[model samples]
Target chain A: MKTRQRILHYTGEVVLILFLVIFLIPLIQTFFTALKPDIEIYKTPVHIFPQHFSNVHYLHVFTRLSKDFISFFKNSVVITTVSVFLILGLGSLAAFSLARIDFVGKGFIIFFISLILSIPLIITVIPIFMMETAMGIKNSNLGLILPYTAVYLPIPLFIIYNNFLKVPTELEESAYMDGANRLQIFTKIFLPLIQGGLIAAAIITFLNCWGEFLFALILNTKRSATTLPIGIMMINDEEQSWALGPMSAVMILSIILPMSLYMIFQKNFVKGLMEGSVKG
Target chain B: MKSLKQGKKIRDNIVGWLFVLPAFVFLFSFMIYPISRTFILSFQKFNFVYDSKPVFVGLSNYVEALKTPSYLTALKNTLRFTLWYIPVIIVLGFLFGYIITLPKLFSSKLAKIVLFVPMVIPISMSCYMFLFILNPQWGLVNSFLANTIHLPMLVRDWMNDPRYALKIIIVVTVWQRIGFISLLFMSGIQGISSSIMEAAIIDGASAARRMWSIVLPNLKETFQIVGILAIITSIKLFAQVVAMTGALGPNSAGGPANSTLTLYVATWKAAFINFDMGVGSAMGYLMSLIIFLLFGLNFMLTKSERA
Candidate 1:
């Protein structure tokens, strides 16, 4: 029986390793592909290993892709950073109100927001594009940020709402008993309690805004205002046939921040996703 | 004193509304307003560039979507993708979730991180990675199949082929997203109390029996969430399609004979590419209707289960 258990355990380990390798191969390929010289990229028999390493692709990504590549990166950083903070701030306030404060039309507000959230981006982009263009905000960071904040508001709002609901009422009640006003109580007590949810919401919102392509593509037609995904797409479109190294390098650069952010705040991301999933 | 109390009551309501006002303002402007406009546009022959004065077309746009062969093919493709994609996602999600959680799997942390790398990498990049690897003649997978595996018959251009284009896209889509779903399922599985499992074991329940009777039932809500998300994500598959097949495919947006054209891509082509706003808005409404019904069904199912 002991031997059988050991065998079963060994089999589990083997299966785990096998699956890991299968999954990691593509990522490993991307890493190696980014390193390979143009000569090696298209070579016959598909060399997985680079015969000679070169940084030409990396150089080209910085120098040759576009004069506004850095601007694209900057735009993405600025847009994502602004949108995430707005979502968190607004979402938390709304969530706090809905969760803790008994107010008129709460159900209607929640239901309406849910309905609004369900309207997919494809359906709404036309009007958003036109509105932004009409308002003269199109091709600007504000064009993307406002719509992103709106699009992402519901998810974080709901996540934070659930977080607030789960907070022990005693914490807030004590604050109230100690002569705290509603605003003070919210800021001083409730905010501190739901820090995890806030972090999770921030990370998720940042990731969403970072990866957002369609609206960013449509709204920001100018190269300077575009985000990383759009920049990457432009690169892909320009050099569809080859330029694998530079393309892969740009791709790698675009994701490094988000990937590191994910790794760092992964626990919050998971907690937020799990909570959002369950509630949603 | 009563008047002062009334003032405080009004103040409370004001504070409440003030707190929620920002999100509500944004939601109303971007989401509600645009959706309402899209709905209105669907009924009118409205092309911003062409139509000087938009004329009411009634259901003509919907009629166009129904009648147009490309739209129908897109409809079919979207449905087929969802049908094929969701099960694989669910199964893989569970399998990976379960495997990673096994205590016997040495260095599970590294394995988990490997599984998660795909999720963190943007879809555009991942598609490019797969594009290189799945290349027909000189790609990694094809070469491996021909030389290492000795299976020359299976070798083919995956993305360009009409038959395999959508399927390969599905594979790539699943590969990128499965990590996220797996983590979700892992959490759900862990949420299932170990004490319940112990009770099942004490009752002489076999592992399979325990999984079926205890674990499966407990995972119903997770299944619902994961299933709905999978459906929504599948429907939203546009960028990957663009990344895999360049914008200028044979039929445009859907690659070689429009085999890979999805509803979202079709809608984008209509509005943006074709500059036919009315038809595009109509397609958008139709897509929204399908998504609404799917979400509604999910909601109703959960409601019924609770009842």
Candidate 2:
């Protein structure tokens, strides 16, 4: 019985390790390929490790695609930042009202917002394209920011609303007794209590806007306004045909921001996902 | 006194309105308006370029969309993709969930972090990474299989071939998504009372029997959530197809022989590439109808279970 138990434990460890390796192979391969020179990319029997490492690909991306690359990065940063802030500010306020305040038409409104969340972005892209173009913000960063904030509003709103509900109403009533106005109570008491939900909402919104491609692809056709994902897609199309090295480098660069963001806030992000799923 | 009371009531309503006004404004403009416009456009022959009057054609667009071969193929491919995606992801997810939960694994948390790393990277990056690794010539996957394993039979051009194109996309999608599914399952597993497991063990039930009779049944909610979410995400699949194929595949959207064209991609081509807004709007409505039905079904199931 002891031998059987030991065998099972060892076998499980081996299987887990093997699975991990298989899971990470693409990322590992890309890192190696990103370090190789253009000529070595197509070398026979694929050198998993490059014989001679090259920083030339990274240099080329920074130098040659510098304008497009920087613009893409800047656009992604500004759009994601603005969208996240808007969603949080508006979502929290709305959630405070929905969860705490007595109001008419609240049930219908919440149901409507949930419906908005359910609709696919693809369905909304065309009309948004037309509306933004008509309003003359289509090619601007604000164009993408507006739609992203709206589309991602429901999730954060839902999360924060639940967060507010979990906060004790007695606390708010006591704050009122202490002469704290509604705004003061909201900012001082409720916001502090729901900081976890706020962080989760912020991270999810930022990531969603950061990774957003379809809207950015369709709405922002100008090279200067394109976000990182769109830039990666465009560069991949143009460079993959003749130059795989630079493309790999840009791809690697594009992945760093989101990866670090996730790593830094891994716990909150996972908490957000779990909470969102439970609501679903 | 009556006027004072009415005024106070009105003030309360105003305060409530002020709180929710900002989010509602954005939601109304972007979400509600676009959806209504799309519905309206579905009934008209509105092209952004050549149309002058925005002529109303009344269901012809829907008929045309249904008749189009690409749209039909996309619909079929979506169903096919979902069919292959849901079951594989659920089973693999539960397996990983079980593995990491093992007490003997010293670094289970580290293993989980590694599994979830891919989730942070955008689909575009992951898809392109797979494209490089899965390249037929000089690709890591082919090289490993052909040389190290000495099994050339298993090596083939995965993304370009008609038979394997959709399957390959499914593989990458599942790979990126498995971590989330596993996490969901892990949460579900943690919800299970350990006392129940101890009771089963004391009753001398084998590990496999305990899992089959106790664990699997207890995970019914996780299975439902994972399945529904997987189906919904798969239905919206676009970035992976575009990045993986570079829009150079057959039909300029899906992979070779149009084997990977999904409804989302098809709608994109219609609206942007062909400038056929009417057809695109029609397809979007049809797709949403299907998704709505799925949500309805899921709601019914959950409600019934609760009852």
Candidate 3:
């Protein structure tokens, strides 16, 4: 019986290790391929490890590739930062109001948020495209940023709202009695208390805006306004689908920020995901 | 005193409205207005490139969508993708979830982190990575099979083959998502009461038996959540198809004989590519209708459990 239990435990460990290796193969392959000299990319019996490492692809992406590549990176950063800031600001305020305040039409507002959550974003793309084009904001970063803030609002809003609900009412009441107005209490007391929730919302919003493809694809046809994902697609086109090395470099570049954020704030991400899903 | 309290109430109302007004303004413009317009547009004939004005054509767009072969194919392909995607994701998710949560496993933390790496990266990056691995000429899979394993006959052009194209897309989507789903399931497993599991262990139940009789029954809510999410994800399948299959032509996504064309991709092609907004709008509503129906079905099935 003891041996049987031991056997099961060892087997499980082996399976897990094997699965992890298999799971990470694509990512590992992409990293290796990115570093491989251009000539080795097309070599037969594709080597998992690069024969000779080359920084040419990386250099090409950064220097030799058209000025558009740098702009794509910059555009992704600016758009994601601005949109996430908007989401956190508007989301936290609305969440605070819905969670803490007694007001008319509160139930209606809650229902409205949930309704928007259920509707998929694809349904709105066409109209948004037409609207943005008519408004002359199409092919611009602002076009994507505004819609992203609006569409991605409900999830973070719910997360932050639930966070506000978790804060003790006594804290707010005491602050109120101590001469803090609503804004003062909110900014000073509530914000610090639910810092975890706010960070979680920020990380989630950042991830969404960073990787967003559909709207970026449809709305931003101009090279200057394109985000990373669209830029990668454009790279595929510019390379005429043959230059895997530079494409892999761009892929690595696109993932670096999100990957680093995930490594650092992984706990918040899990917390945010679970909270959003459980409540949503 | 009454007047003062009433004044405070009014102030609170004003404050709350002020707080909510900014978010509502964005949501109304971007979400609500577009949804309502899409509804109206579904009932009209408009083409961005060809038409000067939208002519009212009530019910015809919807009727025509039901009749069009390509639209029907897209609908069929979406359902097919969903059918394949949901079960595989759920089952693998459960298995990985169960394995990662085992108390005796020393590497559980590492496993959890590694499994979730795919979730954090951009979907397009993953899809493109798979494209490199599955590229016909120099792709890793083919070269490895033919050169390393000497399985020359087994190598095929994966992305362009009609028979394999959709399946490969499913594989890529599953790869991107399975980690996240597993984590969700892991959370669900952890949510189960520890005492019940301890009792089963003391009673000398086998691990498989314990899992079946205890953990499985306790994971009902997780299954429902994961199921609905799978359905929704499968329905919104766009990026994977676009990235994996590559574009067949200008503004077209589903390719290699339309085998991988999904409703979402088809809608994009129609509205944006083909400049046929009417059919696209109707298809969008139809997609929403399918989602609502599925949600209703899920609710009904779970109603008894809740009660």
Error of 1 at A266 (Å): 1.9
Off by over 4 Å in 3: A1-4, A240-242, B1-5
By lDDT rank, best first, the candidates go 3, 2, 1
- What is candidate 3's CA lDDT for residue B167? 90
Best by TM-score: 3
Using all chains and alpha carbons, the TM-scores for the candidates as numbered come to 0.94, 0.95, 0.97
Q: Local error of candidate 1 at B229, Å?
A: 2.3
Q: Assess chain B of each prediction and give its TM-score.
A: 0.93, 0.92, 0.95
Residue lDDT tens for model 2, A158-261 = 88888898998789889988998888988999999988889988887887788887988899987788898877777665654426677778778877888887
lDDT of 3: 0.87
What's the interface RMS deviation of candidate 3?
1.4
Cα lDDT over the full model 2 = 0.85
Candidate numbers sorted by DockQ from highest down: 3, 2, 1
lDDT of 1 by residue, B191-221 (tens): 8999998998998999899989988898888
Candidate 1 residue runs with Cα over 4 Å from true position: A240-242, B1-9, B247-251
lDDT of 2 at A148: 92
Task: State candidate 1's DockQ.
Answer: 0.64
